[model samples]
Target: MSFWDDRYSRDEYVFGEAPNAFLAAQSHLLPKSGKALAIADGEGRNGVWLAEQGLDVLSLDASPVGLEKAKKLAAKRRVKLSTKLLDISDYDWPAERFDVVAGIFFQFAGPDLRDTIFAGMIETLKPGGLLILQGYGPRQLEYKTGGPGILENLYTEALLAEKFSALEIFHLGDRDGEVAEGSAHVGKSHLVDLVGRKAG
Candidate 1:
C-alpha cells in the first residue's frame, strides 16, 4: 500500500471532517455556482465543504484509500463530490475549466514538482477565478504540529508570489497560529495563506 493509503487506513479521518479554516474563510470570494478543484483533498474535508457551498467539486489525491473515505464523507454530508486518483507530478491538468482551485495544506511536493502544480493550478482557472492556497511556513518545522519535515517543502511569501505571479494576488502572508483541523493537524503552527485571482 502507498504511504498515504497506509496513513488513512485507520477508522478516523487523519485531518478531521471539517474544511480547512483558511479555505472556509474565503466564502465571500467563492462563485455562486461553478466547478472547483480541491488538490490533495485527502479525506474530502475541504472538497465536501465546497460541495456544501453549492459548487461542483472534484477532489483529487494520490491515495485511493483517502478517496474512498472522501466519497463516504460526501455521501454522509449529502453532497456530490467527485474524486480522482492523481499523482500530481504527471497529471495532465485541464485548461481554464474551474472557477475555484483550493490547495489547502498540500505541501508534499518539493520545489520542482511544486512549480509544476502551481502553474497548472493557474492554467486550470477560468478568467477571474479564485485561487485559495494554504501551507506550512518554515516555522512549522519548529512548531512540530503538522506538515512536511523538509524546509524546501514549506512556503514563504516570496516563494508564493514568485510562483503564482501570473495571478492577481490580493492577500499573501504567513503567521503563527493555532491549527485545530484534526488529530493529524493540531496545536501551534506556522501557516501561510494566499488568495489570488486569475485575470479576466
Candidate 2:
C-alpha cells in the first residue's frame, strides 16, 4: 500500500468530513447545473458537497481505501457521486469538459506532472467554465503544519496565474486561514486560493 493508502486505512478521515475552506468560500460561484470534477478527492468531502449542491460530480483518487470511504460518505450524505480509482497522472482527463472543476489541497510531484495536470484541468473545462483550486503556498513550509514536505509541491499565485494564463482570474490571493481537516491538517494554514473562468 502507498503512504496515502496507509494513512487512509485508519478509521477516521484524515481531512475531516467537512468541505474545504476555499471550496466553501467559493460555493456561490458554482452553477446549479452541469458536470463537476474533483481531483484527488481523498474522502469525498468536497465532491459530496458539490453533489449536494446539485451538480453531477465525479470524484477521483489514487487510494482505494480513501475511495471506499468516499463512497460511504456519499451514501451518508444521501448524494450520488461517481468515484474513480485512478492515478491522477495516468488517467485520461476527459476531453469533453465540465462546467466546473475543483482541486482542493491536491498536490503533485513536480513541474512535468504539474504542467500536465494543470493543462488537463483546463482541457476538461468547457469554454466559460470555472476552476476552483487551493493549495499550500511556499510559506506553508515555514509553518510546517501540514501538506507535502517537498517545497516543489507547494504553489504560488504567480505560478498559477502563469499556468492558467488562458483563463481570467476572478480571484487569487495568498493568506492564512483556520483549517481543520481531521488530524492531518489543522490550525492556521498558509495557502494560495484561485478562482478563474475560462475565456470564451
Candidate 3:
C-alpha cells in the first residue's frame, strides 16, 4: 500500500466527509446538470455533493483505499458515483469530454508536473466548460496547516493565469484564513481559488 492508501485506510475520512467550503460556495457556478469530473477526489466528499446537485459525476483518484471509502460515502449518500483509479501523470484526458472539471485541494506536483496536469485538465474540458479549482498557495508553507509544503507544489494567481491562459477566468483570488476541512486541513492556511471557463 502507498502513502495515500495508508492515510485513508483509517475508519475516519482523512479530509472529513463534508465538501470543501470553497467548492460548496462555488457550486452555483456549475451547470444545473451536466457531466462532471472530479480529479483526485479523495474519499468523494465533493463528488457525492455534486451528484446530490444532479450532476453525473465521475471521480478519479490514485488511491484505491481512498476510492473505496469514497464508494462507501456515495452509498451512504444514496447517490451514484463513478470512480476511476488513475494517475494524472498518465491520464488520457480526451479533448472536450466534460462540461465541468473540479480539482479542489487536489494539486500536488512540481512545476513540470503541474503544467502537464493543468494542460490536460484544460484540454479535457468542453468548450465553455467550467473548471473549478482550489489549492494551497505558495504562502501556505508559512502557515503549514495543510498541503504539500513546497513552493513547487503550491499555486498563485499568476501561475493559474499563465497555465490556463486559454480559459476565460471568472474568479481568482488568494486568501489566508481558517479552513478546517478535517483533521488533515486544520487551522489557518493560505489558499487560492479559481473558476474559469474554456473559451468557446
Candidate 4:
C-alpha cells in the first residue's frame, strides 16, 4: 500500500477529522452557495464543512481509505459531498472552474508536481474566485510536529507568490499557531497561510 493508503488504514486520522485551522478561520469568506473543490482532501472534513455551508462540494483524494472515511464523515455531518478516488497527478482538473478552491495541507513531492498542481489550481478557479491554502513552512522542521519531513515539500511565501502570480494576494504570511490535527499535528506550529483571489 502507498504511504497515504497506509496512513489512512489506521483507525485515527493523521490530520484529525476537523478542518484545518486556517480553513475554519476563513469560513466568513466562503460563498454561501456555489461550487467548491477541495483538492487532496484527505478525509473530507473541509469539503463536508463547505457542503454544510450550502456549497456543492467535490472532494478529491488519492486514497480509497481516506475517501471512505470522508464519506462516513460527510454522512455524520448530514451533508452531501462527492468523492473521487484518483491520483491528483493523473486526474483531469475541471475545465469550467469553481467559485472556491481549497488546498489545505496538500503538499507535493517536488517542484515539477508542485508547479503543475498550482497551475491546475489557478485554472480550476472561476474568474474572481477565491483560493484558500495553508501548509507547513520551512520553520516547521525545527518543531518536527507534523507535516511531511521533506524540506522540499514545505511551502514558503516567496514560492506562493511565484505560484499564484495571476491572483490578487489578499493575505500571505508565515505565523505560529496552535494546530490540533489528531495526534500527528499538535501544539504550536509554524505554518504559511495564503488567501488569494483569481483575476476576473
Ranking by lDDT: 1, 3, 2, 4
lDDT values for all models: 0.94, 0.89, 0.89, 0.87
| Residue 13 of model 1, lDDT score | 95
TM-score each candidate.
Answer: 0.99, 0.97, 0.97, 0.95
How many clashing pairs per prediction, in order? 0, 0, 0, 0
Q: Which portions of model 4 show Cα errors greater than 4 Å? A: none
lDDT of 3 at 120: 88
| Model 3: lDDT of residue 55 | 91
Q: List the residue pairs that clash in candidate 1.
A: none
Full ranking by TM-score:
1, 3, 2, 4
Model 3 steric clash pairs = none
Instruction: Give lDDT: candidate 3, residue 147.
Output: 92
- Candidate 3 per-residue lDDT, tens place, 1-200, comes to 89899999999999999999988988778889889999999899999998888899999999999999999999999999999998878799989999999998875678887788889899999998999989999788888889998778888889888888888998998898898887999998898988999988
Q: What are the runs in model 1 whose C-alpha is more than 4 Å off?
A: none
* Cα deviation of 118, candidate 4, in Å: 0.5
Which tens-of-lDDT digit does each residue in 108-180 have in candidate 1? 8999899999999999999999999999999989889999889999999999999999999999988999999
Worst 10 residues of 1 by lDDT: 84-93
